[model samples]
Target chain A: MKLNRTNLEQRLDHLYDVIVVGGGAGGLSAGIYLQRFRLSSLIIDKGKARSSWMQSLHNYLGLPPDTSGRKLLQQGKKHYDSLAGDFLDGYVEEVTDAENIFEIQVKVGRQNSRNVKFYSKYLIVASGIIDHLLPLEDMQNVYDYAGYNLHVCMVCDGYEMTDKLCGFFAGSEASIEEMVFNLSWFTPKITIFTHGLFEVSGQMRSQLQEYGYRLVETPIQKFLGENHQMTGVELVNGSVIELETGLISMGARYHNTYLQELSLEMKGGNLVTDKLGRTSHPRIFAIGDLKVGLNQVVVAAGDGALAATQIWREIRKDIGPRKWLMNLKLPT
Target chain B: MKLNRTNLEQRLDHLYDVIVVGGGAGGLSAGIYLQRFRLSSLIIDKGKARSSWMQSLHNYLGLPPDTSGRKLLQQGKKHYDSLAGDFLDGYVEEVTDAENIFEIQVKVGRQNSRNVKFYSKYLIVASGIIDHLLPLEDMQNVYDYAGYNLHVCMVCDGYEMTDKLCGFFAGSEASIEEMVFNLSWFTPKITIFTHGLFEVSGQMRSQLQEYGYRLVETPIQKFLGENHQMTGVELVNGSVIELETGLISMGARYHNTYLQELSLEMKGGNLVTDKLGRTSHPRIFAIGDLKVGLNQVVVAAGDGALAATQIWREIRKDIGPRKWLMNLKLPT
Candidate 1:
């Protein structure tokens, strides 16, 4: 069934209608929808989606509890490739928009010698969020149990955390409150350790007292563990608190450098999109974790579909006889 | 290895904080979040989702093409049930809100005589949409090819229409123009017809002319088919438009009647929900296909998670000391 295929270099002159930057759940889903809508698309991925760091995901529907993050990404890439979607393993360095056409500058490869410019009519930024790692010297040994015992999302791993003595490793900001309140859902034996000064309102302090949460303002000198599993934490006060599992509720720092370049509005760290996935920048759209809201795989996929459908609707209007846009008439 | 544990039902009594009224992707995802948020929740569903009408879904990312809608649903349910999530198989006859509580009346079983009532502090409407079926005097033949060759959701099945002549069965006033325009995405060889006067717009008429789409105003006297797959349409005008595949773009009627008893705000036949899945009434939340925005599984799941998180935030505020939400006079 193998037919002789022509080289892609011969077809280099064909410009894509849209180029999706990032190939995580959001980007891949958007690509699937665009291709179905009959629009040519390409995905540029540095291959570091948050799901890649996941050891195992229990809440990802339709997947087995033993499903590994590595396996999930591999399967997703295969599915995208099956559609004949194009991809270049590289990093998008900068983007500039002028006259509704986006000029993307990408730096690819190890030596970083290769530089290429791509022009697209529309852009969808699915660049996912980046996790702030704990500054423990032995952080690698601590992260090995991420998919199994230690976890980030309570919705994804709370069932496993139920009835277990859990420790929330938070810094001196909103992470302290987020951990103290959310960890209450899984177990009552919860302790919030602030590596610095604990900030709280008067009412919040009273609530903490009522909830009976043991709060320690002391910092952690060392993370004691055995075979990649955390056992206890040595405090700066020359004391230790034994624990089975702990979540580093520091903060999710998104690589939103590209977003700063655009004159787009932001709400809750995600691109402010309407019912359709349209940003303030009319020609550009954003979906998935990059755009914000619940950072789930399924939600990201839906964002992709919604964005693709909106783009398709626009294409239809442009391709049709109605060349009048914003009172400007086109030669039809 | 399974143990018949102690009965937790006696303690549960009418204590469910939230009751999600469907077990589709939206309901299950909501259940997962609600449970993780420490809300005593139950999901009652008949287990029939919109995707149930799909044979193969090509746009739902991260899965192989050979995956069936049934497999997706089965796996989704398995994921929910594994988390000790409760779902009753029944049809929700009525949903009435009283003060801050919700009462759901249901009819269960094949006998169709048993009635039951369930109560919850809050409600999340993940009850997805239902597709409306047309009266084809040939009922037996029409039902057989439902999820196979006959399709809905062009975003899900449009890729299969490539290089194939598609016959769109509009049959209704609402679907006439939409069907003609949407089907234009896949093939140029598209024929659209209405059973009666399909008020054609000036712009639409020109698109039809430019695209060379055959439009027939005559009603179909009979459906031409064998082995449950349609081959052609026999028009009352004694005309026959042969087609290999058919798209029933007729229309989908949303189930919003249950919300009518309560005077909730509605916009364009959808419940008006805020960013946190809150309806006009704070006690009530809407998720999945029943609410506003794109009717997608992923979006529904996102709605469910948001609703659960909103409810969780409220519960945490409730559990703390000194009635933080009761307008207590704060000391200056």
Candidate 2:
């Protein structure tokens, strides 16, 4: 059931078994399982899933190597909708843990929006993080090649950049550690670009010299690329360095502001979760990039199934088996 | 590379980065990841994956509700082949763990089989379990509806049995506990059939009577059904008990016999694995039903990705980054 502002008002009184906070692979998978388990779930999505930006997902199992992450999410969303799961294209503003149920305040639209409250017995926080891109003066230069040739995750796109003239764009000194790992696994022709964000230590400079990797501390003027394929970069000093591919090791901002009121267990910017994706609060589960696990689509989808199954077990135990038939309809 | 008896001898000299013991969802997924990471892997399978018997998988994300498990395996196998992962249709007999690499002995054919040896740096034991069906005069009768109207896992098929005249077949007295859980989640109109295997206690009988459930302590003659849909069961005492659906709560035989040589930690029938599916032995891993986790296809697939990533990280750290270009070919 796709809920809009018109139909959302009538469904407000109904308490869902679980409320999923994103419509990415994880949230959609959880909703499909919950509906199959004979439980109601409402997915409130802000439509900013990081996977939507992925042009191609080469590693997801049972999918083609050329399949895009957006296509996978579209199929998952259709599967959830087929199971009659409630879906709303609204942003969750805040979540307050009431005694028995959690109260969710959602902003319905981007402009001329109205606040609405929803209730659910359990909550699944699948709102994933957004990666911080290179802070170039013209940000459009970065977007042209961000998902195509300029990759973010090394584990995902390292093979794509094998043996190429690669550019390792670092956000901080600590990100240089990941560059070393990438150099070992992918290509050795990597030039570390600081983008003038932070100063390189003396010891780090010596290590770079020992490895024979060039260090560029100048700020970038713009990326010189055509048709989403990054070819080279021009520095502020009007010097051009030709490259084949690039990796952005910049940090990301975790999208968990709605859960600020609930002081759940945290590990840095991620939520610490059990094997079943349960947080410090028993009723709340954090999965996908928000939790301390690999930010892969398949891993997040699996986390969703485990969390939904645990919630179903808890709910089934609380409410004992049905004793009477009572005009029961056959499960479709 | 699909290895048969002919090509199997030629590839015996090469050492793979990982050797997966089963070609199920877990092993296939692991093989796919290992190949994408530029690590060689070979999946030696016995071709008796438990998921092959699953008629349809309703919970796997992004797949249609009616997608058969065999279809999923086919797609996964194709994906793995596209990445040029080695695959063999053989049963692993034993694994001898040496200090550096593990030596594996395999039987290629079932009847006129030939012994073969393979070596790998890491091992993933994905040989899943096989459910024990009811022992009857005619075993084909049980197979007719085992994966159809009759089900095995309560978590997977409880919704399918909702509001139906369900026949709960128990293999042991402990299986009755699972029946109670099923009743709470599914249908209350359940009849417990002990198959004259064990004696029912007085307290248990009293509890069944109090809850208005029938206790049938009779040996079943045969199942009555048509077109793979079970209708009823005829007892040996010339009595017929009608049923709309059935659930077999019998136990399963874990297929981890090949790992018996290694003294790896085990919790009952499953291997004690870390969150990354790593066993007590650092080089060995366990996934799917062989490990202590949810027995779901998506969960097993996710476990494979995590285990393969960990192995890639270890190998990358051990072998430092390449120092020279050396006519490197682009990764396909």
Candidate 3:
């Protein structure tokens, strides 16, 4: 059943076998596997996953290269719902472990939101990192081509920018020093745009100069584009520079604040997980961008399945056979 | 291009960025990623992947619960072909590491087959394991329902056999003891069928007797069923034993014969791999059942992606950019 505030309260009477903290590819995959294992699961989604804004998924296997991330999520949601897995369009405020269960505090609706608590025997954190886009007054201007030609991941879209006039927009000199070297693999005609956010050091400036990459320190007034395809950028002092594509290397905003209280084992900004996607906390699993692994949609989906299988193995060993299978229907 | 014996010689002239062995889910997934990454690759398939016999992928995420493994493989092949990935239906004979590249010897056909040699900068061993089925004169009878109700994976189909009169067809007493105890979680009414393969130890017999399970020692048999649904078994002496389902506890044949000369690290039957699916040899990667991980379709697909990305990273660092992307097409 689709979970809403109305039915959520009543459903909380019984503890769920697993509570997935995101509705993105990873969480949905986990929910699908858990439900197939005859274990009850709930997936709470706040909406707009990192990949949702992606213009296309070029490397996902079995999918058309131009298939949009939004379409993939839509299809995944349909698959999850067909299994009768419970899904909610709400934000998870916090998850606190008590005794052997996790008490999740969730908030439903944006306006005059009501808080609800649900219990689960295990938790899967699939909440991924949010990319920091160009900080412009009209953020919609950035969104116009953010996921289009203006890409964030060089590992994903670098090949698409081969031999093109590429612009590198970074927030710091360190970002410029690092990203320019990486982007050099795609195109040598790179122009680093600091947008006057930070001062470029001599050492980094010489490194960029040695690489024959142009550096622009002008404060950008606005991005000039047509039909969601960015054409160029106009400086605050009235100079416009034309470019074929752009790479945004500002930084990332990891959505792991709710998990801060647990103080789980962390590597940089990600939670360290074993091969099976299990975290330091035995009952808590970290998958997708939340875990220290490749942040690909297919990898995230696989992580979910591994986590669900591990959880099933644990529960099965504890309860033994016949207990869970009695509740499942035989496949025809 | 679809690789057949006709174009195999001309293709061998070019050094493939990656040569993937076995055209199962893992190999195909790696092929898709390698082609998308702008790396030239070839997938050599011997045909009839183990999963090809799976009646239905009941637990695979995003697919319909009743989708057959053959159908999934067909779709994956179509997806790979659409990307212009080369696929050859042939068996690999041997792989010998040269100075920097690996030379692979392949046998193209069964009757009047010719030997072909191909060079690859990297190798991915995705040749999965083959299961041992009942060796009977009417083995075709077992094949009719091998992957249907006559399940091999308990974790995958245990729930489907819940509360049913399941039969355990094991080759060894040790296998019988282990599998029956594990299958007990699904149904307690399990009968062991020895088929006169080996002598059952007294200790193991007592253990089965204490579990309130039946034991049957038979010599000759043919499976009885209609439309691939197994109903019962016919013994050599014309005795019919009825059963709702059956579990084949035979062993598996790992397909890593080509790499036996490499002296690569091994843990029991599986090759140990790092998080990115890289084997002990930096240039070689093991995925699917050949690697030490969960043997599921989704996991194999994910492993292929991970291995391809890692290869890309290594190549990217070694040669930097433009060298490879120049061989790639820009996303339109």
Candidate 4:
């Protein structure tokens, strides 16, 4: 059933086999597999996944190299829906475990929305992370080319910035120190832009000098770009710095806050999962950016499959197969 | 370069960064990631992958539930080729390690094929397993519906046979004992066909009797089917046991003979790998069916990405990034 405010009340009456948070690659993948396994599942998506903002996915296999992450997510949702998996656009607020059932409290939509509660035997948290972008009065100026020439995720876009005048936008000295080492792989001509966000350590400044790299400490007014291709940044001091490409070094906001009350084992900001994506909590499975593994779309999709299959194995073993159920006469 | 026999000799002269020994979902995924990482790679495929024979892939994310594995592999190959990754249709015969380079000997084509040797800094063994089918004189008659109705993987196709007349074709007594317990999940009406391959133990016979299941120890003449949907099996005794769907539990042939000389590490028939798909040997990575993990297309594709990213990180650290290379004057 496609879940909305009107039908959400009716659907909540019956407990789902699994409640998957976040309808991104991982959640959608899990939904499709669970439905194929004949398990009832519902996917509650907060909003756009971090991958959806990606301009192009150059590494995912079987896809056109230029395929955007948004297109993949759209297709994944369609695939999950085709299998009769339930889906809803809602932000999960809290989850509490009681008597082997997970009570999930969700708020549908962003503002002045109705709250709903759902119950599931198993819980899969695939709520992906949200990248932290530059804080500005008009953040849209930065986002205009955020996923284009102005990028995040050095691992995904470092190759695209080869040999160009690269700008590193850092929120802290530590971010600048680490990003410079990573960006050097693609280009030697790099300039670190502190954007007057934080003070750079003396040791970090010396290291940058030793590497023949430049550091700019001026606060930026707005990003200068055209046609969704970032060219440079204009500082508030009335001086403009030209750049061929840019990388944001600020970290991400992991959307696992709702899970904090459950007190599940966590490593850093991610939930540590076993090889099969099962968290320390037996009935809770974590995948994608929420788990301690490589944050790639393909990896997340694969994680979803493993978790779904493992859950099915556990359920199958417990119920001793569906043989007895076949013999039961139904009220049809 | 696309490696045909003509250019195979010339291409072998240059050592590839990584030589992937399979062109299935796993190998092609790794090839795409490697090329995107700006690393030279070559994929050597023996021919048709096990996935290529799959009638439908119901669990893979973002794809239609009815998408065939052959279609996925075809798209994966095209994606890899677009990134300029080299591909060859050949069977790897041997892999020898000497002086930090893997010398791979391959036999091209099946009939009086030309033997060729290639060198690589790293090796990814994605050569997946091949399933063993019933050895009937007219096995193609069985294969006509093998992937469609005569399924091999119970985990993948058990739901498809729900409440239907299922036939469990087991090669050995042990296989029958376990497969019967698993097949019972989908349907209670299951008949075990030994095909005169093994004698059923007394304990096993009693267990089948207790479950109200039928056991046929007859030598099968052929499987009767039409339009790629299995109908029944005809025995040499001239009796036909009707079945709506069938599950084959004859096991599989792991394709890692070329790495026998290495003797790196093994868990049963599979090579044990770390979270990043690294085997005991530092330069030798294993993914897909060769690795000890779930043998699914999505899992294999994820394994490929993990293996490729780890390989790239190692190479990047060793070479001190691509910055210096950017400054080098070209021959032109």
Lowest-scoring 10 consecutive residues by lDDT in candidate 2 chain A?
A322-331
- The lowest-lDDT stretch of 10 consecutive residues in candidate 1 chain A is A1-10
Better of 1 and 4 by lDDT: 4
Model 1 steric clash pairs:
A270-A291
- Model 2: share of native contacts present? 0.51
Q: What is the lDDT of residue B94 in candidate 3?
A: 97
- Return the clash pairs for model 4, or none: none
Off by over 4 Å in 4: A324-332, B322-332
Cα lDDT, all candidates:
0.71, 0.88, 0.84, 0.87
Instruction: Give the number of the best model, judged by DockQ.
Output: 4
lDDT by residue (B30-126, candidate 1, tens digit) is: 8877765556787877667786766676656656766776676778777666666666776778888777778887666656356677789888887
lDDT for each residue of candidate 1 in A1-332, tens digit (9 for 90 to 100) = 00112233342455678888888878888887787677888788877887777777665655665677667677767777777777767678888887878888776665734667777889988888876655656666556655456666665666677766777767654675665666666666666777764665667556665666666677777777776677777887889998787776767777567556776898767788776678888878888777757777667777888888889888877885222122233448
State the lDDT at B30 in candidate 3.
87
A1-332, model 2: which lDDT tens digit per residue? 99998898779899999999999989988888899889999999999688888898887777777888889888888889987999999999999998879999999988999999999999999999999999998899899999899999888888898878888899999999756555647887878899999999999887776666778999999999899999999999999999999899889999899999999989989999999999999999998999997988889989999999999989988887665344243456
Q: TM-scores across all candidates?
A: 0.86, 0.95, 0.92, 0.95
- By descending lDDT, how would the candidates be arranged? 2, 4, 3, 1
**Candidate 1 Cα misplacement greater than 4 A, ranges:** A1-14, A194-212, A215-228, A234-240, A267-269, A321-332, B1-13, B110-112, B196-210, B217-229, B234-240, B321-332
Per-residue error (Å), model 4, residue B31 = 0.8
Give me the iRMSD of candidate 2, please. 3.3
Chain A TM-score values for every predicted structure, listed in order: 0.85, 0.96, 0.95, 0.96
Docking class of 2: acceptable
